[model samples]
Target: MEDDIYHVVREPEFTALFLLGADDLVETVEDVDAELRLPDGTRWSASFMTLGAVETVMNRWRETGEYGGGVFFRCSDLVIVPKGGVPAMIEAFRAIVADGPQETLGNLG
Candidate 1:
C-alpha cells in the first residue's frame, strides 16, 4: 500500500509543503519549466529533486488531476506554489533541494 502524507509549511516568502504517494522511484532533479514559472515570469529550468518527491507529485496529479501538464513538481517536503498566490514557492523548493532538510527526508520513505 502507498502512504500519502500532505501538509503545509509556511515561510516568509514561500509555502513549503510535502506529499507522498504510491508507485515508482523518482530519483532525479526534474525541470518542470513547462509546468511552472519563475518570479521574473520565466519557465522554471532546473533538475532538483529526489525519487520519492517525483513519485509524490505524479501521484498527486493522477489522483487530483493537478499539475497534469507537467508544469509543477513536488519534492518530498517541498511543494512549489500549492495554493498559487505567491511566487516564492519555486525559490523555496530550490533552497531545500540545495540543502536537504530533516523534514524533507522524513517524507522520502
Candidate 2:
C-alpha cells in the first residue's frame, strides 16, 4: 500500500504545538461523553465536540498520505527520497489520505 510507498510524518511536535495553542485559546476538548483535558488547565468541556473526528482524521492520514479533504499540509512536506517521480509521489499521497472507513482505525460511527 502507499503507507509503505510514502514515509509520511505529521510532526507530533507541530500537532502538539498547534493543539496546545488552540487549547490555550479555546481551553478544552468537549463532547467525549466527558471533558478531554490537555496539559495544565486547558479543559475540553466545550468546543470540538467531534472527538471521533480526531481519531478519524489522525488515522486517516496514517492510512493515506494527504489526510481527508486535503487539509494536512505535512503530506506535502514528506519527501520521496531517491526521488521517486512526482506521479508516484502524488499516487502515494492520495493513497494515504483517502476518505473511507479505515480498517485498523475502525468506523467513525
Candidate 3:
C-alpha cells in the first residue's frame, strides 16, 4: 500500500481513521492500526487484529522462537475483531468505547 492510503470513518461523537498497516483493499486487510479522536480532542489508538491474523502471528513466532514459543499473545493496545476489514474494526471500536472498559484502548494524548 502507498503511504498516503487511509480510510476514514466518522461518527456522531468521534472520527476514526484507519492509518498505518492498512491495505489498498480494506476488505482484505487482516490487521491494521487506527486512531480514534473524540469531540473533546481525546485521542486513542489500538491495533486491530483478526483472530486468524493473531493465530498466524503466533504460529510464526512458534517457528521463530518468540513469545515463549508462541505460547501466548499480548499487546499493550490490541483490539481483536471477529472479522477483517476497517468497517468491522470500527464497529468493534465503537462497542468498546460505548460499553466496554477503558483498558481496551491506549490513550494517545
Candidate 4:
C-alpha cells in the first residue's frame, strides 16, 4: 500500500481521499479504503467493497481457511456498493452521508 499516493475527489458536501495500492488502477478498482472529510472538519474512514469483490474475497478466504471458512463476511466500517470503480464508491458515501447515517463510517480521531 502506497500511503503517499491518493485519489482526491471533492463533492459538494465533502471531500474524499482514497489510498491507492502499488498496482491499483483507479478506473477499475472494485474495492477502496478511503477517508472522508466532512463539513464539520471531522474525518471518517470506510472500506467500500463491491458485491462481486466481496464474493471473490470470501471464496478465496474459503480456500485459505480464513473468516470461519468464508461462511460470513464482516467489516466494521464497511459500505458495500453495487458497482465497481471510485465514482460509484464516492456516490455511495455521499448518499450515506446525506441520509444522516454517519454510523456507516468510522470516525477518525
lDDT of each: 0.39, 0.30, 0.81, 0.85
Instruction: State the weakest 10-residue window (summed lDDT) of model 1.
Output: 25-34
Whole-structure CA lDDT of model 3 = 0.81
Look at candidate 4 and tell me the lDDT of residue 55: 95
TM-score of 4: 0.89
lDDT tens digits, residues 1-109, model 1?
Answer: 1123423344443343333223312222232221222233332222334355466677767778778755566444334333322234346565654574333433221
Colliding pairs, model 3:
none
Report the poorest 10 consecutive residues by lDDT, candidate 4: 1-10
- Model 2, 1-109: lDDT tens per residue? 5334322223222101112222222223322121222223332221122335454666677677655544553321222222222223333333333431131112213
TM accuracy, model 3: 0.84
lDDT of 2: 0.30
- lDDT tens per residue, model 4, 10-105: 888998899877777777788889998887898899898888989999999999999999999999998888887888888888888888646678
TM-score of each: 0.22, 0.18, 0.84, 0.89
Model 3 lDDT-worst window of ten: 19-28
Superposed by TM-score, candidate 3 places the C-alpha of residue 27 at a distance from the truth, in angstroms, of 1.3
What's the C-alpha lDDT at position 13 in model 2? Answer: 20
lDDT over C-alpha atoms for residue 19 of model 2: 23
lDDT score, residue 43, model 4?
Answer: 89
Measured by TM-score, how close is model 1 to the native structure? 0.22
